[model samples]
Target: MESPLKNFAEVARKFCAWAETQPVSTENEVKTAIELLANLSSAILATSNLGFGEDLEGERISDEEWRVTYNRFGFLPFNYYSTFFNPANVGKEEPVIGDLADDLADIYRDLKAGFWLYDRGHVKEAVWEWRQSFQTHWGRHATGALYALHAWSTNESIQL
Candidate 1:
């Protein structure tokens, strides 16, 4: 039996691969990808609070590579309303456009980092890194991406 961490890692890996290669030519394709991401995000958060530890060696893909893959989804129009990252003090929600390709890439970048560590056999580091980043960062992007994808699929006639 696979460990929970490995199971989650596999899901992350598969999602990344699928996202990168999946067809976006039709609404059905996009909806399927969105569903995969939403489920992945939920599963990630479910186990995020279950551990604590130091991270091991890990690496990130080149920014160029990230942007390149991000560009592949350029054909997609991933638009959503974004809140100001630091609006609590202002007490005003400044709305902005959130791009799904960019946001999805952001989430995938973090997941790839975790995947890197796990692939290299640093299991503890992978889980720690994933949990910490999920809590601190990519979780927002993942959720936002899901929302944008869903809204796009359900209401293609409307842009949010």
Candidate 2:
């Protein structure tokens, strides 16, 4: 059987490669978004079993670098959406505005950081980076973006 880490690495690499290309058409972008998000969602689940490693001090992405990727996702149909703190208190609690582009950009940055470590032969550090970021950051963005993308893809009449 293939190692879980290896499996995750493959998915993460594929997602980064696709994001790098910056798909042009609206239809292609939507389809790719759904596919990538679904695959990433599944791949991330495997990281729970990965052991923690010492931080390798991977490079941080600057705001300028982030905006480059964020802007590349400009073609996403749905940019903004409403998010609730608790589903049961949806009406009582104020909904926060979520951006699909922000989610994609953030996820990309997080994964890219791990990539930097992984490519440099720091496999354990790479796994640690992925798992830690998944818990603290990108995981939330991924779920939110996946939910929005799924909704948009399923319903043709859903307006932006």
Q: Estimate the TM-score of every prediction.
A: 0.80, 0.89
Q: What lDDT tens digits, residue by residue, belong to model 2 across residues 26-124?
A: 877887887788878788787654475765766767899889889888778879987765657746888889998999999989999998898998888
Model 2's alpha-carbon lDDT is 0.82
Model 1: per-residue Cα lDDT over 39-90, one tens digit each? 7776776664445555364688789978976876665655445655654648
Location of the lowest summed lDDT over 10 successive residues in candidate 1: 48-57
lDDT of each: 0.72, 0.82
Which clashing pairs does model 2 show? none
How far off is residue 112 in model 2, in Å? 0.6
Q: Report residue 6 deviation for candidate 2 (angstroms).
A: 1.4
